[model samples]
Target: MSDKKNENGISRREFLTKGALGSFLVAMGGATVGGFALPKPTVSPGPSRRYKLGDPGKFPVGTAMKMDKENIFLFRDVEGFYAITAVCTHLGCIVVRVDDGFACPCHGSRFAPDGHVVEGPAPRGLLWLEVSRTPDGGVMVDADVEVDLGTKLVV
Candidate 1:
């Protein structure tokens, strides 16, 4: 009866359009606030690790054992004990120790017993982590810290 619609007399199209506009505005406002309120993602080194691998004497000389769960190879040569990462340098694939050396099944990368890359596609040698004896007499491998080549933990 009048040019102005009565209260509660909104057409379905008008109602939907207004609702959509309101939703869009609310979403944009929330996004703008969130852009400033949300914390920015940070690039940082991972936390330090000190993994205990039990008594050092458990590993014997001339024995090479793979701790698959820890992604490390505990080796005891006639000289001493050492640790080499089982992770392939090429694509982070876990390497398996063969008679000759370590091999990556994922991308055909090969590493020597000393963790040196003997084949292509690997950028560098496998990581040699820092190994030390804890006060509790357990052996600890610091995966977060890599030591120089030929570094050994002689028990």
Candidate 2:
């Protein structure tokens, strides 16, 4: 073949290169525009860390109620209400409530009734979550917020 220039004074190889570059630029521009056009989420996307357990009266004093779905145990004592995570500190396994306290079946980690580490393999004791009373006299627990041990919300 002959190395002849096209009508636009560009050779076949130059034309092909320019075409490829133009296509790439157009594709990138479209992607940018599409990204900008996408709607932004107003709220974060994920499972909520805060749970509202309605009616403080529902949880009577001197009772320990386990919320399996939220992986937390709610306790209401003579003083007030408190929450502790049921997840084992060692391996994130669900701990079963025993007569004495809690036990992890996954790796044999044990916790006391007050969530202090009783057995080995666990780095620390169970987490104590923040418990608060809502404006409507409802109980709310925030799993994401860890409070000091033995902290109770006196409602």
Give RMSD (Å) of candidate 2 vs. truth.
Answer: 6.8
lDDT of each: 0.84, 0.92
Q: Model 1, range 86-143, lDDT digits (tens) per residue?
A: 8888889999999888999999998887889899799999999888889998888887
Q: 46-99 in candidate 2: lDDT tens per residue?
A: 998999999988888997989989999999999999999999999899998999
For model 1, the superposed segments whose C-alpha errors exceed 4 Å read 1-48
Q: Which ranges of candidate 2 are over 4 A from the true structure? A: 1-44
**Residue 36 deviation, candidate 1, in Å?**
11
- Candidate 1 CA-lDDT value: 0.84
TM-scores, each model vs. reference: 0.68, 0.70
* Backbone clashes under 3 angstroms, per model: 0, 0
